[model samples]
Target: MDSIPNQQHAWVNLRRGEPAEALEYRADWPVSKNLEPGEALVKVHAAALNPAGYKLMKFLPNFVANRPLGDQVFGWVRSDHMRLTNQGALCQYAKVREDWIAYAPSNIPLDEVAGFAIVGITAHDMTVKNADLQAGQRIFVNGGSTSVGAIAIQIAKSRGVHVTASASAKNEAFVRRQGADEFVDYTTVSLPEFLWQRAEEGRKFDYIFEMAGVTDPSMYTQSDSYLSPMGFYATVGPQPKGLYLSEIWNLMKTTLFWHLPRVLGGPKAPFKLVCLDYQREDLEQLQRYISEGAVKPIVDSTYNFKDTLQAYERLMNGKIAGKVIVKVNIEDN
Candidate 1:
C-alpha cells in the first residue's frame, strides 16, 4: 500500500440546524497514516449518505455538529482506524476497522454499492434475522423508497414473503421493480386507512417496517391496528422532524433514537428499533448477497467530493428516490 497523506480533504459540518447550513470542505485536515493492530487504511472511491447530517445532527451536541459526517463508504482497505483514530469515510482516505471492511463486488459498480453498509445491515437484520419473516407472511414497508426500505423490500421478497411498501406516486414503480408486491401512493392516499382497508380485505400485514422517518405517530404509530396479532413493527425511529426542518415541530421535537427490535413497545405489536449491528459474519453475508445479485445498491444521485456540501443540501431537501453519494477524487492519492 502507498504511504498515507499527512493531510487530506474532508467536509466538516459548519452549522447544525439545516444541512444547507452545515458543511464546508477543508483542504488541510490532518489524516493519520499509521495503522494499529486490526486496522486498514482505505482509499475511498465513494461514500453514501445516511440521514446522520441530513436529520440527526440537528439534535446532536455542539461537538458532533462540526465533525465530518458519513457512515457507509465503498473503498479499498489502505490501513485501519483503530483505538484513537476515528477517521470518518467522507475524507479522501478513510481509516476503517479491518473486520468492518467489506470489499465491493467486482461485478457491481462501486458508486451504487457505497450506500449499502449501514442501510443494508439494518434492513437485513430487521427483515430476515430479527423479524424472522416467513415464506407466506405479508409485510408493509412504510417508506419503501428509502435506502434501508429498498433493501428491506428485496430481502423480504427473496425470502418469499409478500411485500407492500409506500413510496411517492413517482417512485411507486421504482419499488415495484425492486420486488414490492403492493405499492401505496402515500402522496395520494391515507396510508393507515389503506392498511386498514387491506386488513378488512383479509390482507393484514405480518410485519410492518417503518422506514418513514416521521414523528407524527398518526402517520404510522397506529399501524398496529392493521397488523396481524403477531406482527413485528420495525423502525429506525421517527423521521427526524421533517428532513428540511420546514415544520416548527419538526425542528423542536426531533431527537436521536432507535427502536429496539424483539422488544415490545407499549403498542400491541412488537416493535424494534433496527440498529446496524453487524459482525464480520454479517458483513460476509452482505458480500455474498451482493455477489449473488440478491441485493442491489440504489444510488439516487452523485456529487463530486468537493461538492459534498451540495450533496448535503440535496439530501436535506428530501423526495429523493434512493441514496445520495459523493465520489472522492483519488487520482492524485
Candidate 2:
C-alpha cells in the first residue's frame, strides 16, 4: 500500500481574524487530521481557482455549503466533499468523502479536470435548474470566456438553445469555438445597446445567465426592457468590492436594490442569485458530458503548488479566457 503522511504541507491563513486585504500565503505549514466514514485518503494532483474562495469568511446555507471548501480539482481517488475550509485544496493530501469524487476520464489529462469541478456544476445548475432552458430558445451570457460563462455557453448549446455572448475582441474566436452562435465584442460594441437593438427587432432571450465581471449595474437592473415576456435571469459569483464589510454590504445592497424588486413585482424582471449543490448524480452527469464531448475543460494557465498564492492572485485579477489552476503533484501529472 502507498504510505500516507500524518503531517503534510499546506497554506495556513496567516490573516485569520484580520480584514480581507490581509492575504494568506505562508506555505510549508502542517495539517493533521483523521478520516471518517465515506472518507478515504487522497493525494491532490491539481486544484482549480475560482472567485468563490472570496466567500471563505462569508456565510452559506447548510444544504448548499457542505463541501470542506477548496480542492475543486483532480486528485487520487478518495472522497467527495467540496465545501472546504480556508486551508483547503492547497494542501498536499486530504481526507475526502468517496461520494465527493468522480473518477477522471482516461482521455483527458488529470491536471485538466481541476478546472471542471466547480464551474461545470455551477453552469449545469444555472442552465438546467434555475433557468429551466428549453430547446430552440435564445440565451445571452456575459463574460463568455469566464470559467462559468464558458461552461454555461456549451451547456445551453448542447440542448439546442441559441447562445449569444460578449467578450474581449481577443477572445471572440475562442468563445465562438466554445459553441457561441453569435459573438459580441464588448470592447467595440456596447453590450446593453447591442441587446436593446435586438430587442427592438423583436428578438429577446428566454434565459440570461450573468456570470459577473460586467461593470454596468443598469445592464442588470434594466434587463426587463430587453428580456422575453416570461424569461429568467440568474447570476452566480458576486463581485467583491472592498476587503472588509464591503463584500457583505454589497450583497445586502444588491438584494435590496436588484433581486428584491425583480421578485416582488418591481421593473427589473424575474431574477435570482444561483448557487451549486454538490451531488454524486451531478458528477456522474459531468462524466457523461465529458464522454460525449459536449463540454471540455478550458485551462488558461498553470502554476506550481509552491506558487499557489500567485495562482490565486491571477484568478483574483479577473483577466483570463478560462480557469487558472495550481499543480500540486505537478511533476507526475
- Candidate with top lDDT is 1
Report the number of the highest-TM-score candidate: 1
Model 1 Cα lDDT, one tens digit per residue, 1-333: 345568888766556666556666688887767668876556667777666646644211000011123333343221122223534667776665567665556677767777777777788888878888889999989889888899999888888999999988888889998999888898899888898899999899888888876565553456667888877667777654534645545424332112323243435565576776667676667778888888887888988877776877788777787878778654623
- lDDT of all predictions: 0.69, 0.68
C-alpha TM-score for every candidate: 0.81, 0.81
| lDDT of model 2, residue 63 | 9
Model 2, 10-114: lDDT tens digits are 544454432235445444455435666777546677776666454452211110111234333342221223435334665666555567666665567767777
